[model samples]
Target: MSNNKIIDLGSSEDPLVLDCGKSIGPIKTAFTTYGELNETKSNAILVCHALTGDQYVASEHPITKKDGWWSLLIGPEKSIDTNKYFVICPNVIGGCMGSTGPNEINPKTGKEYGLDFPVVTIGDMVKAQKLLIDSFGIEKLFSVIGGSMGGMLVLEWLSKFPSYVFSAIPIATTTNHSAQNIALNELARQAIMADPEWKSGNYNIENTKPVKGLSVARMAAHISYLSEQSLHEKFGRNLQNKNKIEFSFDADFQVESYLRHQGFKFVDRFDANSYLYITRAMDYFDLKAENNGSLIEAFKNTNSHILCASFTSDWLYPTSENKVIIKAFNALGLNVSFVEIETDNGHDSFLLDEPEFFQTIKGFLDATYKKL
Candidate 1:
């Protein structure tokens, strides 16, 4: 296998145990792999994806036919340098992509899981990836890299299986979702469930979908991902291809039109129920909580080296949040590095073509890989 297709683990006696204490079996993990695993399997790296990403990391998205979201950063000669390392990216279990998610059918009822699907956490996501990695016969990973929710998964992977990971890069993510972040996620969930067509998350059975509700949810969440400076610079008060204001709520401003477009396009590819599940998982993420409210305790004896980063304009996961993680690593006397990139690209800066961000990753990984 070229690691470019789906791999169905099928049903086994051993099921994935969730943080909620529920066990699910026969999970189908959809992943894409690039480069090749060497004889010793020491050149493998795991790239986790953000909220809307899928397994198609450096390849064309099958649904959109557009270039991969992170194509600018991960390729043969790019910062990640696929030519020198084997990279694996898998869709989270509760994701809308090919992995087993809310859209999958329940074996007993033979219907889509929908709201019935189990709530998954960052730990659950990493546990599933462990299964996939073990299937590849790769015991230890050279590095695990991601930003935002992907970054959360990176931290979880290192925390849960320190011996299995050598290095980690968590960019623009917090150790836990703040109260404001939780509130914002709740707003999106309310928007989706409030739509009459949602039908209590049984829209699939009713042969209808909540398009308007999901679109509004996406629009609301999209605003939080950007900064005031970014929005103003990109759109300002510019009219949307019009000579005068429409006088009505018909997207009079260019920014409004852009957000509407983002919302509409999102509903086409993402599942509302999956969005609810994933956001809930993120809200429940609190590493310190698991370690008696002490961030330092969470890292107890971890040996994996960490490279933490934050963006100047990212209000979602600010530098303050990254500092907490860095402090914990330092308290543990662990090998860790940090950088606050100066940029106006907001939380999405990690995804954009930031030369310094690219170089930092290239330099860190290149130097780390040599020691392995």
Candidate 2:
């Protein structure tokens, strides 16, 4: 296969075992792969995504009809540089894409699972993806990289299956969800579930869904991805649709208009119940549980080279949180490097078109590829 070609893995229809000894029934994971698998299938890179992201990493988005979300980093001669390595991006198990999510019909009832779907965690998602990797017959990965929730996935991969990857890059993520982060998530869920139109999360029928509630939730969640400076620079006190104020609940300021637009667009594509379930999964993730409940112990036997990045203005996860991860790597004296990017991009910085981030990614991949 040429580097430009992409292979598709449709689904996992069988009952899948969970690390917790529970079972996931009829699970289907949707994923896309770019580039060739190489003679030894050693050039594979797993592209884990943040919340609300999907497997369309470097392809066109079917829903938005726009380019893939991370096309900025995963293209010819780019950071991920599909020309050189096989890249795989999977729609997370809890996502609203082609993956089996809450919106998917429950074969048992012939209706959307909605709240009936089993709640999944970051570890569960990783285990599911591991099945996909094993199907390829590739025992080890060239690298695993992600941001925000994606970053958390990277951390979990290192801890859960340390010997399965060659290197890891986790950007702008936390060791565990903080009280403040959990509070924000709770508020967003409340907003979505609060709408009278929610109708108990079974919005798949009736040709209707909870727009106001979902939009409000997206609007609130979007704010956390940005910083005050970013908000000021992108949309400040500038008036919306008028030079003067017509204050009524109308989107008078540009910021309000942006947030409103963000909310409205999100509701069209995402499921309200999936939002609740995914966020809850993230909240329940605690990385230190396996290694006698100690974070440092998790890395003692790890050999995967790691690159950890944090942003200066990302108060959501914050630089301090990144330090906790670095400290763990230090205690084990693991092969890890830390870079706190000096930027005003906040948590979403890892998502945006940042040239410096691209460079760091390129450098990390190149150093690892040379070893291979």
Candidate 3:
């Protein structure tokens, strides 16, 4: 069973202001918590979810009936051990999960927000999360951890509310979206918008869905999440059941069938419009630009111990991109640790079962908690 919980934050009187100069009230935040909060509430750790991830960090997913996205790394005696730390994971505002998003009803129009939802930014998401953190009366978090887009949220927390975070781990992520990253996201967006069923984002009102468009979008984006070596190792040019190559334009190769499965299954649980919005938010993240083009200046305020990690084959957010963040921290003379895990799993390495990755995080958290 899913262990999701819902909380209402930012009422009409104190609406959440967005980077797009818009305001939303009574934002619904879906979250889940594991372990127990100590009397002082000092052992709380905020685990941010990545794109396409929900609040079911270490629990079963209600829709997919599969283990939580980070199930391997979190639990009773896992890396972010629930036996000792209180972990809170919130579905971001522009997500398709139980959180507020384009698919959610708009109280003003009595219909789904759809295209009317304000263009949310990474900063806006972090602001909404802060409200949830406040609702718990958590003055400070023991640690904040995440990977990829989730890592972006971790960095945002460190930048926007440095004092509130004690330690942070941002894995396989960058401070900003590189040009290549933006281009890749744009490709996915165009794929969705090109479908005839999209109907200008009004498909929901017509009782239709851009499933094909969304599927293709997922297919294209999924390739970026893996490395060439992993794909080759997993399913070379092997045929999909048949021995001879099929001359038709069908899924002849195992890899082709695998991607198609990933794409179609993704559309089953994810909303097309939510995909558009969340990807746009990721493309717009630029921590350096937010702080006047000074990465060091962005983090000069607080003294939180930080750990930045990147996978060796993560071309999407390569080790080089991650090093930029480390350089900034080093420039400020902050207590920071950086590790590049040797792996061929690419950007998705953080989500996989890597012994070194798990040990690195476990060792760091154990040391950090002992200090407190």
Best by lDDT: 3
- Worst ten-residue run, lDDT, model 1? 1-10
Clashing pairs in 2: none
Rank list by lDDT: 3, 1, 2
Whole-model alpha-carbon lDDT for candidate 3: 0.92
Question: Model 3 Cα displacement at 228 (Å)?
Answer: 0.4
User: Tell me, what's the RMSD of every candidate?
Assistant: 1.4, 2.7, 0.8
**Residues 22-71, candidate 3, lDDT per residue (tens digit)?**
99998999999999999999999999988888899899988888889999
lDDT tens readout by residue for model 2, 1-372: 111222233333656665556566667778888878888888999999888888888888777777877889997888888889999888788788867778887767888888888888888889878877987888889999999999999998898898998999999998799999999999999999999888888776755689999999999999999998999898879998798988588989999999999999987778888899889878888787656778888766678989999999999999899999999998888888988898887889987888888898899889878887
**Among these predicted structures, which one has the highest TM-score?**
3
Ten residues in sequence with the least summed lDDT for candidate 2: 1-10
Residue-level lDDT tens digits of model 1 in 232-345: 999999999998997798999999999999999998889999899999989999999998998887777579878999999999999999999999999999899999999998
For candidate 3, the per-residue lDDT at 1 reads: 63
